[model samples]
Target: MSAPRRPVLAGNWKMNHGPSDTARFFADFLNRLAPADDRSVVFFPPAISFAAAREALQGRPDVRLGVQNVHWEASGAFTGELSVAMAKDAGAELVLVGHSERRHVFGETSDETAKKVRAVLDGGLVPVLCVGETLDERNAGRAEAVVAEQLAPVLSIIRPDEVAELVVAYEPVWAIGTGVTATPGDAASMHHAVRERLAQAFGREAADAVPVLYGGSVKPDNAAELMSQPGVDGVLVGGASLDPGGFAAICGAAG
Candidate 1:
């Protein structure tokens, strides 16, 4: 039988924390995060703070680092954007693709996101592809449809063999950073839908092995319950992750 899916606790700093703050955050985070062999933990700090986060993560190789975003092109006048190679050089082992802000705030299209996913994979980095629906979409009963649409382009490009390294995060736009969260039941249902979509793209065995995380206002109080739900392989934390102690508490809960 295939091995069980490993839990992944990832933090998306999202324009918050600089080099100094990153160093201090890791200093405290590492202390509170107990060593574990059953799960994986990753941090996607702002690009500017990559070095500081890397330096701080010296002894803990188990804790991986990632870029919040990447450009599809290897090099160009895409001014103000970092290429996949640059991100890899910056010590990123993974890359976040199609984050809510990038989709809504920055007008990123699924086609573009597809290219970024391909780029990240080609550059030998893992891609944490974030897919979710907006508040209106959910209210209109189109949440699952919206998420499937977003996943289509990216999923079509991923080979069955790559499913194990691909991390899909379901972060409903309405709940993110809005002090709102989906109930465990609601989150689990969505996660189940995501897995079904994965199964359609890759086979059941490969899909079941993919880590599907929930990431809408996830906090310490509700983390364990969310992680305990079937099909919720892990979480992608936002605001709550900014706090060293709080994030550590959430990580501990994942175990």
Candidate 2:
């Protein structure tokens, strides 16, 4: 209805694609890209490929780099953890907080995600806070409740202005890689609920401006329709993103 929010097509490599593979992916992707300024594109490479992503994407204003995750502290005694400052230093302009894998596999809580979100914002890096419901939750008709639960702590901590600085991704666990996608109506409903929640916690302005992305089995065939729905801003692509051609097609449709 509002011309759909500016399209943001992001790829989450997720534990796949090393630096060399990452470079190769970008090499092929860059060549296939049709220049367009209407859409926002981001590459969420694995932590190990940050440097390679930066190198490949440098001087390419149309594409930006985002890291899959970042530790809340600037520096710490923590091992195997990357700090927010380190993400910035690695040429990442954005960071994903509370991704589904991070929440389900690593047992990360919403409170922890809130801490990372705050740190990312404070460190001047945009945070794409991932929120979603699981298969069981959806079957139980608790999808909306689950989303609010996952997002509440984070929303409770940030101000209206701060909310404007963040992007909320609605990635249902059931649809992530099972090749199942929520119908357009389903995705739109969740995004609308997200907006209502935002309006309650922050304000109308923040709710309107904050992009609510849908992630999960998003492909070229369905991208345009999903993106066209009200309150559905963009997509966070998973498996389809592994192939440069497939990903490019999705971006093209999004654009």
Candidate 3:
């Protein structure tokens, strides 16, 4: 039998929570769920709440801390940007790159995403690299193509040994924040394709070791089904993640 991929149920609390909110969420979540011992339930709070998160989540080794975004540069005059060094200093152990919001809203290109991925890995932090297809592309039967294109640059930059540390979130653009979810079968198919691509690039052993998560409108109602699908290692939750109880419930499904 192959080694199991530890499920990662990540809460991407984007621009929604303050420091107080972060503290409150954990306090409630820890009370509701005892946290699965075998999975990674990461909290990707906005940068402003990292300090509060670190404080609130202390002593809970079962919970991992992450940040929504990070700059590739270590330190410079990149105004309004938080570098990996800054994130590390602020107690972030994982960082997200290529999130759809960073791609579409902030105009972060694949090359820039690649830079961030490399920085995070080199800095000893894990990188959750998001990749996906737009509605039009999926309708055109270019879903796989789009995912490949988006991931190509980052894969090219990362070393083979670092492959296992990467988490690829297959988020369909149309489904994100739109209350629509890619059916479990559909998400599994995409995840299979992603694994095939990784195998081609880094060989099967390394590929199988990497966790490919499904994102985009994942909720408690559907989290179990999605995570149960073959090749779907976990979930990268958005809106539903804001609710501590809801997110904890999703984490429960992952195990």
Global CA lDDT computed for model 1 = 0.92
Per-candidate total of colliding backbone pairs: 0, 0, 0
Over 21-128, each residue of candidate 1 has an lDDT whose tens digit, in order, gives: 999999888988867778889999998999999999998988999999999999988988999999988889999999999999999999999999999999999999
The TM-score that candidate 1 achieves is: 0.97
| Pairs in steric clash, model 2 | none
- Measured over all alpha carbons after superposition, the RMSD of each candidate to the real structure, in angstroms, is 1.4, 2.0, 1.5
TM-score of each: 0.97, 0.96, 0.97
Q: Write the per-residue lDDT of candidate 3 for residues 143-206, one digit (tens) a residue.
A: 9999999999999998997897888999999999999999989999999999999999999999
Stronger candidate by TM-score (2 vs 3) = 3
Q: Rate the local accuracy (lDDT) of all candidates.
A: 0.92, 0.89, 0.90
Residue 63 in model 2: shift from native, Å? 0.2
lDDT winner, 1 or 2: 1
